[model samples]
Target: MMTTAVPAPAISVRGLEKSFDDLRVLRGVDLDIERGSIVALLGSNGAGKTTMVRILATLTRPDAGTVMVDGFDVMTDGANVRECISLTGQFAAVDQILTGRENLKLVAKLRHLDDPGGIADEFLARFDLVDAGSRRVAGYSGGMRRRLDIAMSLVGNPPVIFLDEPTTGLDPEARIEVWTMVQELATRGTTVLLTTQYLEEAEKLADRIAILHEGRIVANGTLAELKELLPPAEVEYVEKQPSLEDIFLALVGKNAPEGELR
Candidate 1:
């Protein structure tokens, strides 16, 4: 019988450390993200999630520990690590002055890829922005702008994508749109590591959830696995009935003036 070796993770961090003067952002954090999977980094406002992402993307150097992306060391092989990763920050980085298509083309050109126009066209169609391709990004909706920003980050098909608080300021509807987009990225074999404070977002998107607290990953596992950390709740059953509010709404919908309840 022959045994197959396990493949290396797309992104790996061990004993990572970082500090800013008196503030220590990360302390001996370790994580491994499998290839083509979505891993949500969950933390509160000051949990250093962004700091960890910056180090992985090679935008910031870690004070200690070994970090690797796509088999390339972030400290020693910075360029290769960068080539393997794309970082999308909290806010959309699209140009308000340029058309949505132009923004994609600009990124494609910067990456030195052949046929920027074609790349732009492909992404615009893929992100369902073909109609708004020619309109200035300033006129696009929040969801549309976010989609375009993500498409720009993917111009060169980087193997790993870092989304740092991707849906920070979007409305509920817009947030849902971005959530769907994140799911699509994983389905297309793109490895995504998104940092977010929204617990529901992590529950809905991540294959595995890692909770960062006080500069360390305190918990890491799937939703069910995390649930096992706590004692299971006592199962209870009770009769249910519609409340007065629910009954009133139901009645209004059927009998209100001109069906105005809608």
Candidate 2:
């Protein structure tokens, strides 16, 4: 039988460490993200989530240990690492003065991709921004801007994406909209490393969750496995009720435009 070698993980980190002056942000952190999977990195404020992501994106140098993205060593092959990944920061990095379509074209043109105009149009239609494509991004809603930001990240169709708190500052409806876009990425076999403060977001999106606590990945597993780490829950019966999210979505999702805030 002919044999095919297994592909490397989309991202790999081993004994990673970073610090600023006296404060150590990441300490002996180790993580791996399988290709085409969505892995959530969960940590509290100052728990080094952003630091971990920055290192992965090659924006910050690690104090120690090996890090790799798409089989390229981040330390020695920074350019190759960058070529394989896109980083979408907490805030939408769109030019406020440019129309939504212009923002997408700019990223494509910057990458020297052929047919920037067509690429921009494709993303606009795919992201449901065709209607707003001509409007300056300054007038865009929170969800629309985020969609465009992510659309821009997809310009080269890089194999890996780093979304740092991708849905920050969005209303409930907008948050759901962004979540759908993320799911679509995974379906298309794009690897994603997501850092977020929202526990529910991880619960909903991640195939596996890695919790960074006390400068290390204290737990990494599926939701069921993580739940198993705690003592079994007490069994009880109560009247069933809708959560705030349920009620909010019921009243908002049906009537709003795809990603517009209600």
**Which candidate tops lDDT?**
2
Q: Which window of ten consecutive residues has the lowest lDDT sum in model 2? A: 253-262
lDDT (0-100) at residue 27 of candidate 1?
89
TM-score, predicted candidate 1 vs. hidden true structure: 0.88
Per-candidate TM-score against the hidden true structure = 0.88, 0.89
- lDDT score for residue 62 of model 1: 90
Model 2: per-residue Cα lDDT over 1-262, one tens digit each: 9999988899999999999999998999988899999999877689899999999989999999999899999999999999999999999999999999999999999999999999999999999999999999999999999999999999999999999999999999999999999999999999999998787898899998887766887667777655544334344754444332332233233442232110
Clashes of 1: 0
lDDT of 1 by residue, 19-131 (tens): 99989889899899999999998766777988899888888889999998999999999998888789999989999999999999999989999999999999999999999
Look at candidate 2 and give me any clashing residue pairs: none
lDDT accuracy of residue 193 in candidate 2 = 93
Clashes of each: 0, 0
Where does model 1 exceed 4 Å of error?
235-262
